[model samples]
Target chain A: MALSAVRAPKIQLRQVRKVFDAHEQGMVALQNVDLDVSANEFVTLVGASGCGKSTLLRIIGGLEYATRGDVLIDGHGVLGPGSDRAMVFQHYSLYPWLRVMENIKFSRRLQANRGELTSSEVEAASGRADALLNVMGLSNAADKYPNQLSGGMQQRVAIARALLPRPQVLLMDEPFGALDAQTREVMHDLILHVFKLERATIVFVTHDVEEAIYLGQRVVLMAPRPGRIDTIYRVPLPAQRHQDMKHAPEFLALKREILQRIRETSGMKTDLELLEKLSHSVSISSLRTQG
Target chain B: MHNFSFSRPARRPAWFAVRGQIGRREYWMLALVGLVVPLLLWWSLSASGLVTKVFMPGPADVWNRAVLWFREDDLLGDIGISVYRVVAAWGLSALIAIPLGLAIGTYRPVQALLEPLTDFIRYMPAVAFIPLVMLWIGITEGSKIAIIWIGTFFQMVLMVAEDVRRVPMAQIETAQTMGARRSEIVSLVLLPAAKPAILDTLRVTMGWAWTYLVVAELVAANSGLGYAILRAQRFLQTDKIFAGIIIIGLIGLLLDQLFRALHRKAFPWLYLR
Candidate 1:
């Protein structure tokens, strides 16, 4: 558990492919997807709706099995779902029957048998739940249920619940997609704050390009039609970045490039003038030309 | 620069205005009217002699009979016995049904094996099995309890099974990702998620169990409010009959309220809406 000893990628997916035959018509979700996510890295997977980014995240979270290839954590092949990985899904996956405080301590409570929960264990779990409630700014909602909260508040609780377990790798599938525009902005900052404080490896899946670039140290832009990683762009912002950085020349240029790549992958004509502006400013290449 | 303009706003009738949900205060207000109207109608008809005394007793006659039964006729004893039988039978049914339902609902092969048998038994009347139950266990207390068991067990099993099946798959998967074992999923995830609906199923089935109480009493030699009512019917004591009917209705209402209150207190998060 020492920080210095954890050097390699926290999670690795090699030659992973997923196909669905449960339906009458079979469909390929992902093909030949290879990704190496380093420790404490905030890597965002951005793509079109059918790009299988969620499927890739699910494979790592052990919710779905890859049809072919390997999913490894710290270099060991995953046999089934494990506690090392925690996932926050798009549908506000907090347990509806549990209160905010109880939801955050779900993992700890489950780890210990219910009737036999020791006093010391209860004290420790409660302490962690209290700290997380403050961190997520949900102290007032400690006793409230998920259904009683707003969509944004519910997602925050979900994030806190996932983080409570201190999972080695946190996998989120479009955690903020259901929020309103203003709430989404607040969540972006909250996620970055939690990421800095916890310093855990995170792989966030989203379809919003600007959000991917805004939060990710490395934005993995994926493409559809057998869902492959088309390119990866390293965000060139400083460590102490603010929302205003989104308007900077560097940020906009990278965003414009990724947007163009997305449009091209989806089989739409790329505007030549937009491409000229994107190419002029960036030093790091899209660097992922498919064979 | 921006310019401002004013125009008359359109209005709609009050009846077309829809509110989010009816508040508890408003609900109780309507319930008051609902209670008074039925009783007032009965009182007016009986007092005005629209129905003959031989057919229907006035409220006073029924009330006096109720007092006499409570004072002299062991009415409380009979009511207590009937309630005990229903409780024992329903409790037994729940004990067997909850676990069996969870199993049948979760595992496909278990469901396939038991569901057809359960479906067939529910439609067969419990009264039809009275003779068979007498042959097996004799026309003792066991037969009465058996009649109630036949009346409620299969339906309860099927209902609880449906409730367990309706628990979301995503919650179960989430529990697994949190390192929950196969058995842990049932205790922590499936049971808690289905708590509200399971309580509801028990509440509904309890009323059905009450409906079969008289049939269960019919098989026995003596005792219970149902036996008392049947004895009064043979003597043509319609006033006594009305008293028994009123007591049964009041008991059913009391039990329904108890379950409803328990539901509200146990799962306020669900009832808040």
Candidate 2:
């Protein structure tokens, strides 16, 4: 059995503190947050809104700069937005102007443009893009623009684009948050399939505890009010996850326990308020759909 | 968690339905109504003789004058001259405006330095510049072209800047995350992303170019449609004045339609939703 527990840490965050300057005072988005993720490990950060889970993910992705402390990738100080880390936002951040195949190709070309490729390399890259599209079940819609795609399809293309350069770390902020229940189920299976296919470290942030436990080998529970990790739970599920496993008594037991822990970690009033604010920030349709 | 519904019921009236999309048939019918209603009003007023022909020429009188202008006089020559001047001046304005607007929009320091000045200048009507332009350029074709350019350039700059600002921040960040250099981001992401709206800005400002043409040819010109209108006004050739007005409207409509068609062809994906 290949276990990630014994592996060396691929990503190390040392006392990361982020304080956003408000008008008169500062808001602490993360307070001395420290986390270490091993290579090929799938870690999911679960919490109610405003727990700074997304902020933590963004810091790791280099989309944001932390006010204090260091983020190190492979024992090196993190630089801003390199090709080594790729992100999939909750909002389908696919380029609206580019077609699916072109979007994947463009992001890949930008990252991997170490001078012109030989014709064979170009052929291989095209083959990989096509294979990714097939895995995402978007082969038929390759020529369509992002605007023409459904929400699930758009997110799939976004994930494909993020995967094009074969990034070492994949940061996803609720990648399937906007999808319907059926689509989300399919996406979960698709994501699990992709996880099995590749051996990259993934950090996923979501509000759903069940999803966190389902997708991750280790689930990190976060709490708001100066956001910090409350606890990290090692999943006891089988090495290979299945849809049927969600209904298993062990899975349900873990899901219920995590739900109770999350509920108590952040009190109801703040959680409800955060949910309201988040719903208003994004479309209500995304929040209304149960995932 | 199950206590409340996510969506609230709309309080819209039963008769007032809202929808984002309209069918092609309905669109054409609405367009037909737009043209037909105005023509109906003109036909009714003219046929009823509510106003005298001298004061308000009927469609027939205007039509007769139009035929005479195109067939007998140097009307086509005047039309050609006005078109050429507008195309030249407007083209020159775009040449300067697009790049300058891009720089102003992309960098806040550039905007801070120039936006206030442009904001002040654009408010001053292009018509107010006629005397000064005539003084500087001495009533040459340069003076006429200067009229359209001055009237359009500043306003276009502000509009292009605004459209540039409206480019999605998410798109830019995405491009950056994809390892695009700053210059590459500007060229591949920002410029192409801002294109459709900039084209729209150009379309809107070109209409202003037409309005300023009358003021442009005010600089002692003996040839444009504006000059013809002025000459007709002096002789009290009311029909010729009306005919010139009709010509301006027709030409403006033609130019607007051509721009719209070209825009559609260029950015088909932009119109999907």
* lDDT (0 to 1) per candidate: 0.87, 0.86
lDDT of 2 by residue, B67-139 (tens): 9988988889999999988888889999999999998999999999999999999999888888998888887
Candidate 1 segments whose C-alpha is farther than 4 A from its true place: A1-7, A114-129, A143-148, A222-233, A249-291, B1-26, B231-238, B271-273
For candidate 2, the docking band is: acceptable
Clashes of 1: 0
Evaluate residue A70 in candidate 1 and report its C-alpha lDDT on the 0 to 100 scale.
91
Q: Is the docking of candidate 1 incorrect, acceptable, medium or high quality?
A: acceptable
Best by lDDT: 1
> Chain A TM-scores, all candidates?
0.88, 0.87
Q: After superposition, how far is residue A18 of candidate 1 from its true place, in Å?
A: 2.3
Q: How high a TM-score does candidate 1 get? A: 0.83
At residue A272, give the lDDT of candidate 2: 77
Q: What is the TM-score of model 2 when looking only at chain B?
A: 0.90
- Interface RMSD value for candidate 2, one decimal? 1.8
